[model samples]
Target: LSKQTKDPRKKVRMLALAHFFEGKSRYQIAEYLKVSRTSVNKWVKDYLDYGLEGLEELPRSGRPCKLDDAQLKQLKAYVLDSIDRTEGGRLTLEDIQQYISESFHIEYELSAVHRLLKRQNFSWISSRSI
Candidate 1:
């Protein structure tokens, strides 16, 4: 089960339990797993308290996106259209940043703009000018 799991953290938890069941000490498991003894102890405790379900990751609430789906779609269209509208058929991050600020009335850091474009499937190479 540990070897098959794609999630590295879960794999560690499963392996820790497996090692414990095999009569390995928590210190031994920690050294073998390259994890802290505290972490190994916690994993063992969680398993004893809640079974296999305790090893699973809990859902986390991350920061929400500034733009919703519809707004993102509109932004993508506008970016595509900018190439046709520009003199050299080139669109830069500054141009997109300005457009986003003017059209959406929302200010985003240049890095955040880059991340947003990436999330929308716009590659860095494609979004750049010659």
Candidate 2:
């Protein structure tokens, strides 16, 4: 079970359980595992309250994306297709922002637009006349 578990916390919990089943005190377990006594207490409590599943990390709440998956896919396609096209010339961040606003009817801040572009692996390059 320990070998199959990849997370270090989970492995520690497994070891704690093993020591617990071996009639070890919480202080003893903490000393042997080199973890805090509070952590051992919490692990034992979690195991008793919710079994092994409780030892796993809880789900985190992350910031939701401004655009949905379909919108993102459409944006990617538009950016890729617009590259090297004569109609719009080289695409810029402002141009992409305008396109997004026009297509999605959502206004995005300049920084947000830049962040989205970067997240999509799009790089901005400046062209200079020789």
RMSD of each: 4.6, 7.0
Q: Kindly list the per-residue Cα lDDT of model 1 for residues 47-122, writing each as its tens digit.
A: 9999988888888898788888888999999877876665665677887889888988988889999999998888
TM-score per prediction, in order, is 0.58, 0.49
Model 2 misses residue 15 by how many Å?
22
1-130 in candidate 2: lDDT tens per residue?
5577899889999889889988999999999989999999999999999998889988779867789999999999998888856665567778889999999998898888888888889887755332
Evaluated with TM-score, which candidate comes out highest? 1
Error of 1 at 28 (Å): 1.3
Which residue pairs show collisions in model 1?
A: none
Error of 2 at 4 (Å): 15
What is residue 130's positional error in candidate 2, in angstroms? 9.3
